[model samples]
Every structure is written in structure tokens, then in C-alpha cells.
Target: MRTFYLLSLLLFALASCQQPAQYISNEGYIYGTIYHVTYESPQGKDLQPEIEAVMMELNQSMSTFDSTSTISKVNKNEPTELDELFITIFKQAQKISELTDGAFDITVAPMVNVWGFGFKNKEQVTPQLIDSLKQLVGYQKVHLENGQLMKDHPNTMLDASAIAKGFACDMVADYLYSQGCKNLMAEIGGEVVAKGKNAKGNYWSIGISKPDDNEFFTQQKLKAIVELQDRALATSGNYRNFYVEDGIKYAHTIDPKTGYPVQHSLLSTTVLADNCMTADAYATAFMVSGLEKSIAIAEADPEIDVYFIYSDPNGNYQTYVSPGFKKLLKKEYE
Candidate 1:
């Protein structure tokens, strides 16, 4: 009887030492892009409905395409009380606009729409049209008073497309954390917020897509791969959304100050920050600031890490990595 009892205890200990549960991956469409989330937890639960609830709520608050969205009402100059998400994004956008000296502006929707990149149809773009739209494109002209957004000009609309996706990624990650998840990766579009460890029991791996307009979704080549744990990553590039007319290439990334798509060699910029929202806004700002100015700004801010890929004078690709960004790279493309 003693030998049998000892054998039973040994077998129970072996069963208790079994491997942990595998990671669960959930993916779907949101905000006009694909979103992917993966998490590992000891307790199994299907959190898709909860995650989609968060996404739909955010969309109702910020989606310009949705006529019933809070942002749409504000855009139409309707007297709408801004939601917490809209207010938070607006406040952050104002700060980024000030920091980048108008390189990042939510009030550039008129220019964006005129360029055929927004909700409105494309118009006959000319110097006069650009100059006229420039009158409506200043962040200082908009303010929030008692939860209401006030605009100096009736047409000075707000568009949060630049930062909304990143904010969504952060929101989803926050929800996962609140649910007792210690390891997870949340990505919306290309913006990502990675926390804890991945399925491999290591830092989450993120890939930076190469700045190629022709093979954006088809080839999908990665320029670099980095381990991002407890970090948010965002990338901005002008190659994908663009049109060519009269031998001139017009990209969707417009300069808020100039009221025209930027004509710079800076192809793409990737930024890493504690939050995806900031990273997303800065990525767009850096694209406007160009490579040299962007490097200067990133160098001054110790918390910001950046990786830049630009076209050199010889038309060949060249890369610039911030001192901190270089440390994150696990693989670098030649």
C-alpha cells in the first residue's frame, strides 16, 4: 500500500508539470485595414466580441467615413459634444502640431480631400486652390470649450485618420491587460502595441515593410525586423497612396503648411514610443520634416527611436537609424 501511494503521487506531479497553453490569435477588419491580435493566457476565453466592441465604439467616436460618428458631426459644423476619445486625440494632436511646427495637423482635411485622399472627391488642384485651402489649415484655429469643439472657420474640419489606428491599438492592448493577460501583441493596420512576451516566450517580433509602391501588398518585403516588447511602433510612407499626372507624382501625404503633397526624398519613417498614438503622429511629422530635421528632433528626444529609409542622390535606397533604434533591430536588410 505504501509503494502504490508513492507511485500515484509521482504520476500526479508529472501531470502538473505539463506545458502551458498555446497562444490564441484573433484577426479581423477594422478602420479600413486589417487588425491582428495574439495573446497567451493560462485561462482560455474567446475575447473577440469584447475586442470588436472596443473597435466599434472607437469608430463611432472618430470615423470620418461614418456620418453618425462624433468627428463627422464636428466636421459638418454641427453642435456635437466631443467624446472622450475625440477629445483625447484632439489634445494630443494639438500638442504634436505645436511640437512639429504644423508638420502634423488634424485640420488639414480640406487639403487632403482636395488631393483625392479623403472623403470628398478630388478637385482641380492648383496653386490658387492650395492657397485658399491653406487659409483653413491651422491648428490654432480650433479649440475645445467645455467638451465642445470650436472652429474659427466653418470649413476647418478635423480628421483623426493619422492617429486613430494607433490609438485603437493602444486601447485593445489596454483591454487585454485589464483582462489579466500578461503576454500579448495588438496591431491595427501597421501600428502595433506589443506587451510582455510572444508565443515563443520571447520579445514580440515586428517587421517594417519595405517602401515600395508597386509591391505594397503583393510582394510585402520587409526592410527590417525588430523585437518590440512593451513598446508601440508606427510607420509612415508616401509611396503607397499616390497618383502621377503630367509626369509628376502626387502622393497622399500632404504638407499641412504647404497645402501640397511633400516633394522629398524621405520615403518612409518608423517610430517607436511608449504609446502607438504618439508614434503614429510623429511618423507622419517626420515624413514632413524630412530626414535631417527628423533626425535632429529624434536625437533631442531621448524617449523617441526612429528608423528612416530614403532615396539617396543616386536613386538608391539608404537608411538612417537613430542610436536607440539600432539597438532594437534583430535583422537589417541590405
Candidate 2:
């Protein structure tokens, strides 16, 4: 899930009123998180079954929790022809890894697990242990050779959790578009794709959350509100999934290159891109690269607009809004 929040039917129009008739909405849980879909259809089509089916297919191909899932089978080193979803995700992951100089790696799952960010309990990780684990980690260590997934080490695994929700959002949103639905928004776990207008015929409103250590998201507060249309928004942060040990802080986002959690003041990154998958990957890349490199990456990519929240030297919250994202901000904070 994202530290960002999808603003609930609150368009910034002068007149704020309810219009359930124009927008058909569905809310439920899938892929271990919440999903919300809204679209404008005069015929009032109930596509919950279709949307749920999409989620089911994605889970079968990518969910690590499913023992029989395609990814799980691959992790087990079984001879399997990767499904279309699996191939697509794997290819996309490789592209992002190269783009970010391996900042966003799917092969870092084993390291993450050892850090207690995955299914395993946290242990006292030493430099020796890290060096040993680094052997089983690296995007270059895995590849699609002649249409088969090949790994450098038998234990080298892949975990697409970082980009799954964003891809799910894109799949759901693209499915709706193919069905001729207009003026719609699809959001899975805060990675979102909003198109056209909403029920009140205004841009979709999304809220970026304050980067506080509210791990369970018990309380929600808006750091900024964005007006979005025809674009995807994804946010990545480590503030929520972190701990302090003996005055040393450890975050869940393990650096793939170093086999350790990143130590940086960069709190969160919200990226807008032509698609949710790209936005999701770069958001994590920005977090891993920290402030200066993140700014550099955003500046180089014309298709990307980013909103970065970081702490100043004084530990006060400050914002860095890329030129493209600045225009989308309906509200801002100091």
C-alpha cells in the first residue's frame, strides 16, 4: 500500500455534492490489500466479477504467498515456462533495474527476508552474512534466456511485491478502458490510474500522506492533495516500515547494491508517469537513490513528474516538487 491516500469524492469544485448516479463504484480487498474502482457508465454495468477475475489471475501468476503460483514455482527452481504476466513483470523489472543502476531490484527479496522485511524473523545481520547473501542477489544474476528464466544461483529468487500493485492498477484500468468505459479511476493499494473526470466531472483527487511512522495507517493526514487525470500516481516510502535499534535506525527498503537498509533523509517519493508500473518502480528507485540522485533522475526523464518529501538537516519536513508535478498539486505544505 502507499503512504498516499485517494481523496474520497472530494473534487475541488466550488460545489461539492454527492452524485452516486453518475459513477458506479466498487470497493473490496484483493492481493492482500484494498482496491477501489469507479467509472461513469450510463448503463450502470456491474463489473465486479470481471475486476475480481483480473485480481485472481494476477495473484496466480505473481503472489509469493500462493505455493502453487508461477513465481513461487520459479523460486523453487522448478522447470516452468513463465506465464505472460510473469514474463511481462520480469522484463519490466529488468528495465527499471538498469535505468536506476540496480536501485530497484526484484532479486533483493532474499536479503529483505533476512532483514525481517519479508516472511522471516529479523536476526542480527553481520557484514559477513551480507557478503554471503549478496551472491544470491542482483538483477544481472537473473535473466530470460531463450524465453526461460535463468538464475545465476539456484537460490536467487524474484519478488515483484514492489511493482505488483501498480501493475494491478494498470491491468484493472486498462481492462476498463478496453470495455469502452470512460471517466474512470482504478486504484489498488494506493497505486492509482485515473482517467477523464469523476462523478462530478472533475479531475480525480488524490492525497499524499504525511511521512509519519504510522505503520498500520491507523490515522491519515494529508500532506498535499493532487488533481490527477490521464496519468498514474504511485508513492514509495520507508518511514512506516522501519525500526530503531540501539539508536540506529533500520528501514524495510534494503539497498540491493549494499545488502543493507538505506540510511537517508529522503522520506518518500510520489511519481507520476504514463503508466502505474513505471511510476511504482521509479518511486522505489528514488527512495533507494536518496535526494540528489532522485532529483537527477526526475530531471532526466521528461515523462516523469515527481513530488519528493524529505527531512531537512534540522529534521523539518520539506518538499521538492518537480516541474511537472508542481502543476498537479492542488494544495501544498511548508
Candidate 3:
């Protein structure tokens, strides 16, 4: 699975555009990345504090970087009961894993840590080490039973990095909606959920990065801009967090089945769905499944709209946008 950060550069509302509404924006750091939230409500309404409280609760429940987080305790094999938040994400992960035939798995934590992509630093990632870690890397090896996690193998661990941010987006959006805000855009990390419309009375506009490997985030140029309304969007790419070793490039997206970094021309995958969590998980799954399989899966599922950026035979960037997704695109790079 690929965990990307700082990839979305969204245009909240065009300044010159008409506005019958006022949009309040709030931003801070969470989940190792920045989050920006904007919503339209009455003049005296400010939900920054409420948003922060929601984020704090989610971080405590799911962040692997926090040693005292609920997920960290579960990963350490400590006796811990699964909270509602944890169970919801766990079940959703299991569903996606099964739907993707294990391509998107939560039990790939050991491989992620070994590859220097998870909470821990990289270790000696030899072939033998990868094989040893593979033994503990199956979603089927873990399950939640009566609000407690059960493991077929004692070493089976979990990592929700792939899907947690999207869930966070959903949670924050729900909070805003509960407060009677009909128009809102909730984003955590790079995953986003746009509800109602922007201040301009138009669907929110979000830009997807051009999959440039020069920098993790700095060299951002838009590949496309999408109009989102009552929908969630997420992009997964391996352009960042990769290295060149022995004349070969190693990307961060690990194929859970192969126990190695994926080597493919598919540069990035962006998915749109009813909720951020589903979009987030499908985006990662599409990256693992490669181009053709991803398109096939997207075509079969009406709920999923996909857009892919890939490198062609001559090493030029190319694109394949699904029909449903093409309708959502506002502009493409010239």
C-alpha cells in the first residue's frame, strides 16, 4: 500500500467568484501531515475547537506514531479492547482486503516497518528478512472478536496508515454536518470529502499533484482539477518515498502478496467514492493491482470512479480516466 502526504492542492473558492455564503477555514497538523478544513455556516459559527477535539480523539485511537495510541497497544500484543473507532476501520479494512484479494491489507505492518515506511525505521531488509516478515502479513491471520482483536499468529500486527486518514476526513465531515453546516470540505492528510458547495455556490475544486519525484511535496503542479460535490476523493502515488539502489528504483508501495516494493509504470491513482475511507482504500488497492486490473475493477464497480497517471513506453506521463471520473474533471494539464 502507498501512503502519500501533502499531495492535494485544492482551490477552496475563487476570490472573484460570486459568494452568497461565507466559508471559514481552519488548518493544523495531524497524522504526520497538515489538514485544512473549510465550511460554510452562519457568521458567528466557528468550529475549529470542535474539529481539533475530533482530530485528537482520532489520533489517540489510530496513530501508530503515538506509542500510547490504541493501535500501538494492540500492535504490541497488549491486552486491549477494540473501540468503536478501531472496530469500524478494522472491519472496513477487512472488506477492502477481501474485495481486492489481499492487495490492500492492514496486516502488512511488518513489511512497512522493514521497508522504512511505517512508524519504525528501516532494518536489514534482506530476502530472508522479507520472507520472515511475509509469514505475519496476511489479513486473514487477524480478526476482531467481541470487541477484542484475535490473532491466528502471535506476531500478526496491524497498520491502518493506508486508510486512517480518509476515515479521519469522514469523521471531521460528520462533525461539521452535525453542527448544522450544510456546506463543508473536510480533509485530513490529502484525502478529502466535499459536501454541499463552496462559498461560490459551486462544487468544490480540488487539484491532484502531477506525480513529480523531484521532491516529496514542494514541486507541486496540477495534473488535473476535479469538481467534487457530496463526494470523497483520495490519491495514492509512489513518486515520493522511493530510492534508487544498485541502478534500480524502489518505490514505497509494497505489494502485500509479493512482499516487495511494486515496480510498475503506474505513477498514481485517484479515486472518488461516497466516503473518503472507501476512496482511500481503493486508491491503494488500485496502485497494488497495477493499471489494467485497476481499470477493470473500477469499471465493474459503479460506486468507484478512477483516474490514473502512468508512464508510457517513451517515459512520458500519460493518463487514463474512467468515464464516471471524466465527468468530474474540471481541467487537465496542458
Candidate 4:
């Protein structure tokens, strides 16, 4: 009887170890893709609904693409007490702006519009127009006053596209954790953040797509496959959202200081950090900085690792990776 009782207890323990349920939340079909969140579940149906609510709030809060967004309001007003979500994103934007030395300014919206990359009606902007736009593209002119956002100059719009999606991903991850989710992965566009493991009890495997000539699919070649346990990853590439005029290819990522597209040899940059916002912002900063300077930046900051792909003057593709990034590469592909 004692042996049978012990066996029963062992079986119970095994049964209790069964995998948790899984749920997926997806929202916002903008910029040509869908943002999604996946979490361990058996959670109430309200789980997805709540996650969607957070995403909706973020879209309403941070989208400069929308005329009704909080950023739009702040740009049009002298002082506005932004919602906590907008405030959080604004703080991160300021930090990144300082770090990149204005290479990644949120106030580059005017340039973005002038270059026809934004919601503004597309038009061919001349060098004179670009020069005028640069005058308004400085983070120093924008200030956060007692949690109230204020822009010193009028007609100076703020575009949080560089960091807002990643912020949304982080917010979704935090919300999932609050709902007792032990594991979750949230991806807003290409910006991704993962917590805990998948249903298989293994880390989530994320693939970095190689920038190839074909825009339809990421090159079959894998740049890096990371096993994310509790981290975020973001990639910025010129392959998407680019237009070639008179043999010069112009990408959407504009240099805030130059008021023009970055004409560097760097093709793409991928960053891995503790949060999606940092990863997203750093990726764009590194992309703008090009290869050598970006490597120096990554080496100086141990908290972030970067991978850069560049084209030589001869148009040959070459890749350079930071020391910290080497640690994250799965051995089989490394």
C-alpha cells in the first residue's frame, strides 16, 4: 500500500508539470504589417481584449501619423500634460536623442514630411527646402516641463515612429506579466520583446532576416538566430521604404543633422537590448552612424550589442559585428 501511494504521488507531480496554455494577441495593421503578442494562457478571454486595449491606447498616444495623437497635440500646444504612456516614450526619446547627439531626433518629422516619407502630401523637396527643415530639427528646442511636454518652436512636429513601436511591445509584455503570464512574446512591426519560454519549454527563437535584393522576402540567408529568454531585438534596414530617383536611392531614415538620407556604406543595423525601445532607437542610431562609428559606440556601451552590414565603395556587401553580439549568436550558425 505504501509503494502504491508513493507511485500515485509521483504521477500527480508529473501531471502538474504539464505545459501552460497559450494565447496570442494581435492588433494594429499599419505600415504594411500586423503587431502581435503571444502569451502562455488558459487565461480569460479578456486577456487578448486587454492587450488590444493597451495597443490601441499606444497608437492613440504616440502616433505622429495621426493628427489626433498626443504627440500632435503637444506639437500644436505650448504645454500639455501627456498621458503616462506618452511621457514614458518621450523620456526615452530624449535619452536616445542625447546619446546619438541629435542623429536620431524625434523632431525630424518636418524633414520626414519634406522628403515625402510621412503622412504629409508627397512632394519633391529641393535642397533649399531641406536646409530650412534642418533649422527646426533640434531636440534642444523641445523641453519637458514638470511632466508637461512643450516645444519652444511652433510648426515643429514630433514623430515617435523610431521608438514608439518598441515601446508598445514593452508595454504589452508588462501587461502580460501582470496578467500572470509566465511567458510572452510581443512584436510590434519588426521590433520584438520576449519573456519566459514558449510552450515547448524552450526559449523563443528569433530570426534576423538578411537584407537581399528582393524586397518580398528576407534573404534565405539568416543573419542571426537568437534564442530570446527575456530580451528585445530591433533591426533597421534601408531595403524597405526607399525610393530611387535619378540613380540615387533614398531611404526613409533621415539624418536629423543633415536633413537628408544617410548616404553611408552601412546597409542595415540590428540591436539587442533589455527593452524594445532601446533596441529600436539604438538600431536607428547605429544605422545613421554607419559602420566604424557604430562599432565604437557599441564597444563603449556594454549594455548594447550591434550587428552591421555595409556596402564597400565598390558596392560589395560586408558585415561587421560588435563583441557583445558574438555572445548571442547561436553556435550552429556562428
Clashing pairs in 3: none
lDDT, candidate 4, equals: 0.78
Alpha-carbon error at 87 in model 2, in Å? 1.3
- Across 1-334, the per-residue lDDT of candidate 2 in tens digits comes to 2323333323434234432335689999998889999987545677889988998899999999999999999999988888999998889889989988899999998888887744246667888989999999999999898878998999998899989889989998888888777788999888999999997878999999888775355786779999897999999987787778798666768899999888899988999999999899999988999999989878988999999999898888998998888888999754
Overlapping backbone residue pairs in candidate 1 total 0
Worst 10-residue lDDT window, candidate 2: 1-10
Per-residue alpha-carbon lDDT of candidate 3 for residues 240-290, written as tens digits (9 for 90 to 100): 767776886667788998888888888999999999999999999988988
lDDT of 1 by residue, 177-233 (tens): 898788999999899999999877899999998888779569788999988969999
Candidate 1 deviant stretches above 4 angstroms? 1-22, 118-123, 214-217, 245-248
Cα TM-score of candidate 1: 0.90
Kindly provide the TM-score of model 4 when superposed on the true structure, using C-alpha atoms: 0.86
Candidate 4, run of 10 with poorest lDDT: 115-124
Q: Please, what is the whole-model Cα lDDT of each candidate in the order they appear?
A: 0.88, 0.87, 0.87, 0.78
In candidate 4, position 255 carries an lDDT of 86
> Which residue segments of model 2 deviate by more than 4 Å?
1-21, 118-120, 214-218
> Cα-based RMSD of the predictions, in order?
4.1, 10.3, 11.3, 4.9
Best by lDDT: 1
- After superposition, candidate 4 runs with Cα above 4 Å error: 1-20, 23-32, 42-46, 118-123, 215-221, 331-334
In the range 231-333, model 4's lDDT, one tens digit per residue, is: 8999998866667768887666788888777776788888889999999988988877878878877787778877787787897777786676766677423
